[model samples]
Target: QLGIVTATRDDGFVVRTLNPGGSPLYSVSELPLKLARKCLDVFGTASYDEESSIHSLNTGYDDEVSSIYGAREFCLLRTTSGKVLYCGKPSALGLKQGGNAGSRWQELIVAKAPKIAQVAAGHEGLHAVLVGDDGSVYFTGTARRGEDGD
Candidate 1:
């Protein structure tokens, strides 16, 4: 599918599809001006810089948890207070088993990790790496199984 991803001046993000042979499945002009601005804002200024200070960042998805579910995608966001926010396509976040269907980003009430420097999400959106200011690394989510299946 032909799609165009763009960030708007209003701090929002949009995804539009373009038809191969037609003007577009939907016209750009007809597209909604506000799409996922709130979601995009969750990541605003949420990055961690080890050189500056120890900040926490939430990485999306946990493969270990997703494996139990249906391998749904999720977004993770960390706050200044070390609170991790989660949202996405999954209905439950591993522990709980039902919600608004991941329609909006929500904070993980039980997750709190302070003094975090950086967080990196895995390409599969199943795991994340947390780097502490002291250069310590922490891994979360599912682990890659070895040939022995240990």
Candidate 2:
């Protein structure tokens, strides 16, 4: 399978996944402007260094997203406002159960790790790495091959 994430001019995001033409099917999800504001508002205002890629929400910049990474089963969005969002298989996110059947844009709550600066998702694996504003690093997903930093 393959995935794509695009940022619209209206400060919203769209995600699409294409599965091989066999058993599974293709899917698409969108994060409209209204919901985007709600997500950003959850963290109040944004703050970052002048030289940093991070930026405040709704600053009218071309792209408020700092970076986007996709793994074997999911995708991670790191915004310029220092927030992290995800769309894809919830199990890849370590959730035992309870998630949408398909992918959807949802906030990734990294307890005690505020203001994510960067994120790395394994394209061929289920692991993910997050770098915080305070230089703290966090990992999630399977422990396969000790990629979880055990």
Candidate 3:
């Protein structure tokens, strides 16, 4: 089954479960942007500049207003303005404890590559693949099964 996730103009999102096997996090038929934001802890707008480095309107991470993708356990959002956001299990992304205690959105940072052209999430949200505007490809998350081609 395919997961459904859409981003609204107000920086909010709509998530739906395609089947009963869908995760409980998005089991709800529809959740308002405000509520979704509150539950996912998705706040702030982040921007990246080649010269100025990375900056966030509120948090340390950011994403533009554009497309959003829902995976089994996480969501990958890519904006037309060249930013990427990931929200889901912090451990799935290999984030250290204490800093990301709860599920929240974080920017996908690729060294020297400030702009992102596309983003993709792997099954169960265990891995992420990103394409940078500079033609650079980035991969994050776990690879215990050689899913990352390591």
Candidate 4:
């Protein structure tokens, strides 16, 4: 387990792009050594700018604005396979990265967790206003203005 990962390639592929970060993303699966090198370039050249990254990653909206305690900013993630998701993070979790609730795009819905329906961002955190089929709202995260939710 030396920990050197490699690519599984195919034929009829070509090198497509190499980012500024030295990460080489390829299209040619036929080329092994070159493909791996290109893939590495694509990964390495990958840049991370805070605001831009966050905006780009915030893709969709399904979660509604809420008065829930932890509800922060959110997104609706429909997988390529066509699964609907209403999700977000609590203020406590939102404040950190790699917490239990992480956004898929912007809204992170953990499997087995309740479906977070709506979200409204607050000054310190966000509010997740959740609703079950019974039409009841469950408030969990922070409210925008110091509990007053002003």
Please provide TM-scores, in order, for all candidate models, with all chains considered together. Answer: 0.37, 0.54, 0.50, 0.27
TM-score of 1: 0.37
Most lDDT-accurate candidate: 2
Scored against the true structure, residue 39 in model 4 reaches a CA lDDT of 13
- The prediction achieving the highest TM-score against the true structure is 2
Runs in model 4 with CA error above 4 Å? 1-103, 106-125, 144-150
Pairs of colliding residues, candidate 1: 58-78, 63-126, 64-142
Using alpha carbons, what is the TM-score of model 4? 0.27
Give a tens-digit lDDT track for model 2, residues 1-150.
667777778656767665666565766444343233432222222121122343333423343676767666666778878887766677877966665423345678888778998888765558888989899999877767877767
Error of 2 at 57 (Å): 17
Per residue, candidate 4 scores C-alpha lDDT tens digits across 12-107 of: 344333334434543322323433321101111111212323233333443323232222344333333223343343344334553333434344
lDDT, model 1: 0.47
Each model's lDDT comes to 0.47, 0.64, 0.60, 0.36
Decide which is better by TM-score, 1 or 4: 1
Local distance difference test, candidate 4 = 0.36
Order of the predicted models by lDDT, top scorer first: 2, 3, 1, 4
Q: Report the number of backbone clashes for model 2.
A: 1
